[model samples]
Structure formats: structure tokens, C-alpha cells
Target: MGNYQIIATAAMGLEALVAKEVRSLGYECEVENGKVIYSGDESAIARSNLWLRTADRIKIKVGEFKAYTFDELFEKTKALPWEKFLPEDAEFPVIGKSVKSKLFSVSDCQAIVKKAVVERMKKYYKRNSWFEENGAFYRIEIALLKDVATITIDASGQGLHKRGYRIDQGEAPLKETLAAALVMLTNWKADSPFIDPFCGSGTIPIEAAMIGQNIAPGFNREFVSEGWNWISSKVWDDARMEAEDLAKYDQPIDITGTDIDHRMVKIAQENAIEAGFADILQFKQMQVRDISTSKEYGVIVGNPPYGERLGEKKAVEQMYKEMGQAFGKLETWSIYILTSNEEFEQFYGKPATKKRKLFNGFIRTDLYQYWGKKPPRQNEMMK
Candidate 1:
């Protein structure tokens, strides 16, 4: 348990951000397609499961094999120690995903693995008893890629994006994972003010409040690893204790959110209260053109509606132009807007300093960032 390798799964285009998060957690990581691999001890795994904001889940790769056929898959899966993780009375089920492989039938592979696990457990326990049970302590997923299979034990049962605060979501709600990534992309600190002008459902402000207060994003939920037989109850207790200790920094951080829809503003207020950050954020109903910028320095990060469930293209363009007019007044504030519209820069009246690809679910979007400064010359010296 002292040495382990784990995968921090992330949304599709934010793999690099997930790697950065892993490294920030004081561990070395290798970035791969839609995932980051890192090494740590048991405690580090617990901490990462509790603290990582941009990841979808933390998975423990249990076994790997070159399984091109059902026999090979069964033999390989049966070789692992299944009884060590599952209790004697625990009811387990398997989920399988296969891609670009000879064993492409997902159901077939799933059935094979399930049979292997059951056989191994029966032999290990030396009992001929097997019964169907409704729930289990853990759920396992097997993924097969080009002639290779990897077995992963899910550490976080429900996706980490379900931070347990957003009970009411308006149409086209942005995921909590992407919202946190938007906050981090701003490179914001606790000293700076943060606001989301088009803040729908208050995802941006709640995530900002969590980040500014150094709160662990997973503190409000349960993990599948907590019920595993191999882990001691003391480990979870220590993890919770450490998370509770980390959440003590609750000073006001000047976080605010506003939306044009009064109903959305009320929902945002309710979400903030549910997340226990109502005191740290101010929610209001205001149009984008009426946004006031009294602060000299801050970050405006948000995901505006891009003609998807909101309105037509021309209307959205006009709305964006008004937003640009409002944001142009803040010369000292950096702006990061996530949108699927490529012509957004035309409305903003300035080229973006940087652009990163991000996905709002299946929709392709770009995070356009405008730093409030010009690029320094290559050979220029500091003053």
C-alpha cells in the first residue's frame, strides 16, 4: 500500500490540466490521452481522491494483459486476487468497454471477466456459495484497447464532477469539472477578485469559492475505495480529518456571480448555500451590458450561451458584442470566455492572447483568454 500507480481520468481535451493538477498534488505524473498517470502511496491516493478538482475519477489499475481472445482474458483476470478487495458477502458487478480490438464484443468480454472473478473468489474462499445481491462495495470496469486489456478498480464510484451541490440545473448546464478548470485556467489567486457575468446555475462562482478557500472538491461525497476490505477504516478517518483540517481557511475572497435571468440568479443562490459558500459569494440578476467593474484587478471567467438552447446566431452575436462592450471597460482584469463560436473574437474587438481546447460534454469549445498586457520583446530586460 505504500507504493502505487494510479490514473487521474479527465475530460477529453484537458489532459494537460489534469497532469498539472497531479503535479501540484506533490507527485510525478505522466500525461496520456484523456488521463494522467501518477505514483503515490495509499495516503496520497486517498488525498488525491478527495482533493483533485479537474479529474473525472481516480482509478487504480488492477491488472493488465494482452487479451485477444476470451480464454486469454479469462485466464488473465482470474490470476488477480479478487477476494482481497471484496468482502465475502459483497455482490459485485462488472462494466466493460472495448475499442479497436479483436475482442470487440463488450458484452462478451464483460461476461468472461465476470465469470473469472466469480471463479477466483469461489476458489479463494473455498465455498460453493454464490448468490445474486443487489449492491456491492465496489464496481469494476474493464477496458480493452488494441489487443490489450486494462482492469481498473473504481476509486470514486460516482463521478467526482457531482460535487453534491448542484441539485437544480437549468438547460445546458456546464459540468462542475469544466467549471473548476475554467477557474484554474485564469491563474487566479486568493488575493484577486473573481466574477462570472454570464454565470448560469452558479457553477462558476461555487467552483471559484471552493478554489479560493482551498477547499477539497470531494469533501462532500463518498468514495468506492472506502468500502474495500483491504483498506482500514482508520485510513478513511485520517483522510477525512486531513480534508477537514484543509477546509478551515474560510475568509472572504470577493467572489461574485451575475446572470441576466432572475430565476438563474435564485438557483445560483440556492446552490451556493447548499455548497456551504453562500457567505463567500454574491449572486445577482443583471444583464451583461450593465456589469460594473470597480476592482482594478480580477478575473472574469464564464461559459456564455452559444446559440445552443438560448437563441439564434445573430441574436447570440449581438449579445456577445454587448458583453464585449461591458468587458472592455476593465483594462486591468483578464478575461477567459468559453464558447463554441469561432467568431467571438471578432465581437470582442481584440485577438486572444491564448486559446485552449475544451469540451462541454460532446460539444467542442475553445477557452479564449485575453491577458491585459502586451507581449514583452524577446530580448527585453526587466526594469
Candidate 2:
């Protein structure tokens, strides 16, 4: 198969992480503004859609050209070989999203690209087709940055973040992709004990379990490219096989989640069971202040409840103080907390050694990392 350029889209502040994910698949990736551009064939696209845990979507760069005007955009887009990617009777949906550029009209660009693709498609099918699409769909994102239009075809149908395990969602629950990214950002080894004290619906703990097992986040979803005529069934089958084979052995890792609410614990357990890591996780109904365990060399990570939902300022302050006390008890464990409240570090009484900006839905959050004392030199080598 001929080589093709592809773009893996990711959320803001995660370009580096997503680039690592792309490169792990043996693709040459360049981290751009909000996406990673890579060179790969059709198989690579399929593999990424099925295995990338940090990316939002995988898109094939079907066309690229300068589009200062509508005519230019239409002509350049029409030049692409639509027949190669889409069948004669295949249903197509041109989903357009524009960023900073001269040709910034989303509706106009959408119309131009749709018309151009349809015009090119007709030559292959010998029919002037202009009917409402149904069934299968391909989202086309048109990014006109600095007057240069980069047209991409979405290979993944829904976002890769929507791992099917999350059947129950609590208020302000972390997204599966974001949860996975937060864990990956820690660079925690599989041997470390991972725990989430304020796990709401078990996203962080479940994601950690999946990572320790090296399971693909897209293991349960169907990609849009699987329905494309250009992508063969054998190719998809091979991709699935590769993903399954890459899935690492289930290590005897200690992963746990605790929530003040017993109902949340039940939901988390259900999520873990659905994610196929039930045996590796333990969910308990415990408050942050009451957590007493003997696990050493573990990492405590969580998106604790914050803001108005956490009640008045006094209550929130008490929660944060107790969270700090919990961290203090784990003399050899590292703690990573994601919170939107600016006073969180103050309440903890110690500044984070490291920090990163992340988005938890529309609200921006700061992922802070606090480390306890390192283990004795002899203990490190004892293993």
C-alpha cells in the first residue's frame, strides 16, 4: 500500500503526549498546534484508532492547499481523488471546523468542500448525487491556518476517549482520555501501586489498571475507517490482532479507589468490571482523612471534588487539608492532584514540585505533583 499522511488530534496541552503515542506506533510524528502530523499507510491509521489512548481522533490528511478564497478552496479540495477514499454510493458527511485563518467561514468552507468532493465523486459514479447522507459517516475537519487549508478525513468515528467501559457517569466525572493522559503524564511504572482517593466513577483507577495491563483504550469501539471501502477487512483484522498481541500481561499490580460516597464506589466497581480489570482493582468506601493502608511505593492520583459542588469555602478547605494529611501519612508514595481551585496548593501546606495545565471539560485545571521521601538506597536495589 502507498504511504499517506495522517493527523492525530488531541486536546490542548497534550500535543507532546499524543506525539509520543503516535511515535510509539513507529510513525514519524511532528507535534503541531493542536494535533500531531504523521506519515503512515492505511494500516497505521487503523492501528492508531484502536490503540491511541491519549489522542482525541485520528484523521488522514486527504488534501492540503492554500485557500485564501472560496474558489481556491473548492478547486484544491476537488483535486483530491475522492474515489480512492470513498465508494460511489458511500454516505459522506462533511463536518467542518475552522481555526484562525483568512477563509474562516465554517459554513462556506463546509459547502465548498462538500460540493468539491461530491463533484469529484460523481465522475467516478457517473451520477450527480446530492442527497442527504444516512448510516455511515466521515467527519471532514477543514483547518485554514494562516490561509493554508489542511483537509483531513476522520478515521475514528467517535472520539477515542469514549471508551465503552464508562456506562455510569457522576457529576463532573473526568473523561476517559483525560484520565488516561493524567496517569501517563505521571510516568508511573506498572510496578507502582496506584490509588485514587476521590475517584468519582473510577476513571483514574480503571485507566491505571488498563495501562498497567497495556490494554488498548479503543479495544471495544468500531472505527469509521472500518466502514470505508478503501480499508479492507483483512487490514482491520490484522490491526486488531496487532493490538491484542501488544496487550501486555496482567501484572499483579495494586490499584485501588476510595470515595466518601458508597454509591460512587459501587459505580466505580461496575466500571472496572466492564473494563475487564475487575480482578486487579479494589474499590472501597473510605474518606480521604480515614485512609489507612500499608502499601508502600504507590502513587496517589485523583481529580478531587472542587468548586461550588464541594460546598462552602470552609468545607472545601477542610477536604484539602485532610487530603494533605493523607499524603503526609504515605511517607514513600507520590501524590498527583488535578484541581481547578487556585488555593489547593495553599491548603495542602506544601507547594507541588511539578505542575502542568490541563482541561477538565471547560474548566482549566492544574495537575500538581508532590513527592514523598525516596526509599532507602538498599530498598531500591532489594528487588
Candidate 3:
């Protein structure tokens, strides 16, 4: 098929990582504030939706222009080649958003954009009857930012994070996308031991297992564009076959997840099973303070309680102190903790070797990294 502009929308603070992933797929990309823009053919859509781990959604950039007034918005949107993408019976729904723009009424923008697209489609299709919209789905979005309107069609219906493995979750569950990002941020290898002391719903450990096995994050999920007639099924079939061929199913991985709550531990185990990592990853019920390992040069990553509520601050601080003491025993194991607590180092009793700012949803958090000395070479360790 012809080349089209594709945009991968990312969570704030993850744009760079998403862009890097796009580049890794052999496509050049431009990193914006909350999205990455790139050019690709029909296959690129399949490949990106299948491979992108940190992105929220993949969309087709139909058109973009500056629109400060309703007239401009309607006219600019109508001028686009909607007929090229949307079929006659396609179910097109318009979603709109306005950020720091003169045309700030989201509902009004949505109505005008919807009317404009319908008008364009009617003129192109040469039909008098209104569209029944009873066929395949096509979700359109009109975003107005700083007097500029960018319109796109959603390729992935549900968010990419819904990998279909998470049947259950805890109260404060970490998103699958963010969990994958946390794993990618580390230097952990598949051969090395990986642990998540606070693996709520087993997101981190399961994600680590997938990464270790070179499994595509979207391997088990379905994308809306897969059924589009414009794109051939061979493109998706080839991409999926490539992903399957690239995965190392027999690769050995040492990954573990633990939680103090027995119920959460059970939930983690269930989620792991659903994710097809039941045999490779181990989940248990244990407190962080009781964590101990004999493995060298291992990695420990966790998303602990941030104690954001006033009543939970003292207890969370104490938990952080205990965690610091427990994890400090592994001199040859690196540790990474994500929390919104600013006084984490003070409670941990040691300064982190490095720290990176990240967002856990809307809450600002820091990934405090404690670098451990690398283990001796294989010969030395074996000696």
C-alpha cells in the first residue's frame, strides 16, 4: 500500500523511549511532546502495533493544519482525503480535545469535524442517503493545540496496554506499558535474576519474562486495523509470523515476584499464568524486608507505595527504611525503585548512584537507582 504518516501516542515522559523503539523497528521518527511521528506503509502499522511496548496507541495522521475559528476547522477538516481511508460503510466516530487553543469548546469542535468528514465522505462516495455506519470501525480524533488542528484515525482500538493477560489487578496496579518501560530502563539480562518485591498483579515480572523471551508485547492482542480492507491480511500475517520467529520460547529466565499481601500474590500468579509466563516466572507472598538472594549481579525493581495520602506517609516512610536495609545486603545486585517520595534517599540511608524523573500516571515519581559493582567474569566467578 501507499506510505502514510503514522503517529504513536505515548504517555508523558515516555516519548523518547517510544521514539527509540520506533527507530529500532528501522523507521526514522520525530519525537514530539506526547507522541512520535513517522512515515511508513501498511505493514508499518502492523509492525508498530505489534512491537511498540511503551506507546499508548497507534494512529494514522490523516491531516493537520492551523484552525483558529469554527469555519476554518470545518473547512480544513473537510478538505482532507477521508475517502482514501474510510470505507462507505465504515463506522466513523469523532473524538475531540482542545488544549490552549482559541476554539476551546471540545463539543463544538467535535460536531463541526464530524459534519465536515460526513460531507467529504458523501461527496466522494456520491451517495444521497446518510451513512449507516454499520460496518468496520474507524475512530477519528481531532486535537487542537495552540491553534493547530491535528486529525488522526485510531488504528489500535483499545489502548496497547491491554495485552489481554490482566484479568485481575490490585488497588494501585501499575500499567503494562509503564511496567515494560521500567524493565527496559534497567540493564537486566535474560540470564540474570530479576525480582520485583512489589509486583502488584505481576505486571513487572511478567513483562520481564516477555522481554527475556523476546516476545512481542502485543503478540496476544488484536488491533482494529487488522480488519481494514485497505490493508491486506498478508501484511499482518507476515508481521505476526516474524514476531513468532523472533521469540526465544525456550530461553531460560530467572524472574520472581513477591508481595506482602497473600491475595495480591495469588492475583499475580493468576495474571502470570494468563500471560503465558507461569512456568518461567515465580510469584510468592513475602514482605520486602525478608527478601534475600544468593544470585550475583541480579536486578531488583519495584513500584512501592508513594504514601501520597496524609495518613499513610509515616508508615510508608518506615517501609522505605526497611526496604533500604533489606535490599542493601545484596552488594552485587543493582536495585531500582520508583516512588513519588522526595525523601526516599533520606529514609533509604544511602544516596542513589543515579536517578531519573518519570511519571506514574499523573503523579511525578523518580526512579532511584542503586548501582552495584558488576560481578566478576565468568571464569573468575566459576573459580
Candidate 4:
């Protein structure tokens, strides 16, 4: 239960958001490229795994040091307090990555690290023979940048993006983490109207619903560290109970997801139902040009087709033009779109008020934002 260094890994361009989320959980974090580092105890592990919306995984940073040779790697790795995290019979597998380091062979580095940890464990547990490796899973990773190696153990078994919803999805469905980032980047309030025109699997709308309801994204998912004996189960139990108490299930939200493909619309509905937002979100089958709304100061967010293929570029450009015309009528509504097209602003017929570079999986995309005027106050409306 002593303080341990914890890391929350994030995708590029999302480190700041992840750091903000970590801070919101009452932990001060230092943001770095692709990861955020912080210090906390055993309960911090459970709380972070259950609450961090933008992080890819939560890891316990065992050690970090400069090692250029295999001997240096082995000695430094063996000297670390592996016994603090791993126990006898624990299934500890070593994975590694090296970048511009003297130990360029990733496989060899992994082997050396694994051997070192096994030696250290043997000394700690006083075991003479080989380990049965038939206990709780501890996935250890060694990441070498330049000559410095950072060793960590994965607390989250699977990627945090798997929120336990969406048993089915269309081709190239947006990841739950990226979808949550898109919603967090917007100024949409829980009381305001929200829509996703390209809601392929209802990720954006469902993530929005969760954010509006203050629901923990990882509430329904299990973590690899949940079975570890050193960490008390009461920590996880308390975190889940706190999440349940904080959720605003009765909070009214006006959100909708629409897609041109009826099958996708059906899929979105099914996903929404799985996420427990069946009655709260409305899914419709409609094209971008057909979208119409009378509500003022609303928000429209979409991840439209990028038309990556050579043959489909023209058709996608036309679709963008039509979308511009259709969406232009709603002057009071803010809009956000994600696409990889370099000429999106030209095709959309208006330059974006702001744009940010982000990665959707491996594809680089831009989030084009168009801000809208705020709605008048109730007193002013009455006047």
C-alpha cells in the first residue's frame, strides 16, 4: 500500500487529455509523450483503471535506468524490487521494444529481462527449480528509448478502449477511447442537444451519454490486476461503489445518432441498448443532406467517410459539399468533423474555425471545429 509510480499510457495528441482526466481523479500527473506518470498507492491503481477515460492502459513503473549492454540490462533489472509486485508461481511474461538503443535486438532484450526477473524471483521466494507459472498474470514490458529502459507491469489486461459494449460493429468502427476524446474536446453540455451524423456503431453517442451521466467508462470491464493478492479487493470495491454513487442515471439528455446506412443505424441502436442508453438516445437512418433540426445552440459531431480510395474521392467530395449546404442552414449549431482529406475545407465550402491533428488508429486525421454563437439568456429571450 506504499506509494508506487504509476503510468497512464495514451495515444499521441491525447496525453494532455489523459493527464486532465488523471488530475480529475485527484492524482497529480506529469504529462509526457504517449504517457503520463504519477505516484499513488494500491488504491490509486484501482481508481485509475476504473476512471481514466482516455488512457490506453494503467501500468506500475517498476524501474527506469540507462543500460547499453546486456550485462548492464541484466544486473539493473535483477536489482529492481520485482518481488514487490510478482509472487512465486506468478505468470510473468516479458514484452519489449527498443528504439535507437545499443540493445537493438528486441527479442534478445526481452529474453535478458525475463531471465533477470526469474533470477530475482528465485532469490526472493527461495525456489530451486523452475517456476510452474500457474498463478495471476503479470505482463511486464520493457521500453527502451535512446539508452534508457523503463520497466512496467500492465494492470489493465486489455486495452481500456474495450468498454464492454458494442458486441457488433461495422467496418472501421471508431475506438471507444477516441470517441470519448472527441466528445471531451467539444463544448457540448449535458443539458444541450447532441448528434452524431456518422454514428457507425454508436460509439460517439454512447460515449457522450456516459459522459453526460457521469458514468465510469470502465465500470463494467475487468482489469488484470483485479486478481493480484497484494492489492486488497476492498480498494476495487470502494472505487466501484464510488462510481455508482457519482453516476447521474436520471439526468435528462437529448442525444441522437444517425447514419445513411439503415444497417448501421440498427447496429447503433443495438450498441446503445447494450450501453444502457436505449431509451435515452435516438438512432435514425438518414443522409447528411436530410438532417434537419430546429433546436438552437445544439452540437453536431461526426466522423464521416474519408474517401481514402482513388475512385471514391469525388463522391466523398460531393457528399461534403452537400453536408456543408445542409449544415449551413443551422447557423446556431456548432459543428465538428473528423476527416483525412487535405482539401476538406475547400469541399466543405467554409474554412474551419479551428483544426487539430489527431490519429484515428493509424490514420492521421484532423478535427475541424466550427464554433457557434452562444444562446441568449432566458431573461433576454423573454424580453
Output candidate 2 Cα RMSD.
2.3
Q: Show model 4 residue runs off by greater than 4 Å.
A: 378-383
Residues 1-383, candidate 2, lDDT per residue (tens digit)? Answer: 76888888888888899999888888888998789998888788888998888889888888888788899899889999877777655677676766678877888898899898888877777886564556456777677778888888888888898888988979778888899998998857798788889988999998888888888888787887888766788888998888789788657788889999999999999988898877789999998988867978778898987765645767878889988887888888888999888889999878998989998878888999987666688468886
For every candidate, C-alpha RMSD to the true structure in Å: 2.6, 2.3, 2.1, 1.9
Instruction: Specify the poorest-scoring 10-residue window by lDDT in model 3.
Output: 374-383
lDDT of 3 at 120: 96
Ranking by lDDT: 4, 3, 1, 2
Q: What's the TM for model 1?
A: 0.94
lDDT of 2 at 29: 82
Q: Candidate 3 residues 254-341, lDDT tens each?
A: 9999999999989999998899987888988999989998888999999999999889999999999999999889998999999999
Please give the range of 10 consecutive residues that has the lowest summed lDDT in model 4.
373-382
Compute each candidate's TM-score over C-alphas: 0.94, 0.94, 0.97, 0.98
lDDT of 3 at 37: 98
lDDT of 3: 0.94
lDDT (0 to 1) per candidate: 0.85, 0.84, 0.94, 0.94
lDDT tens readout by residue for model 4, 1-383: 78999999999999999999999999998999999999999989999998888999999999999999999999999999999999897999999999999999999999999999999998999988889999999999999999999999999999999999988999999999999999999999999999999999899999999999999999998999998999889999999999999999999999999999999999888988889999999999999999999898889999999999879999999999999999999888899999999899999999999999999999999999999877778448877
Residue 277 CA displacement from its true place in model 1, Å: 1.5
- The runs of at least 3 residues in candidate 2 whose Cα sits more than 4 Å from the true structure, single-residue gaps closed, are 128-136, 308-311, 377-383
Enumerate clash totals for all models, in the order shown: 0, 0, 0, 0
| Candidate 4 TM-score to native | 0.98
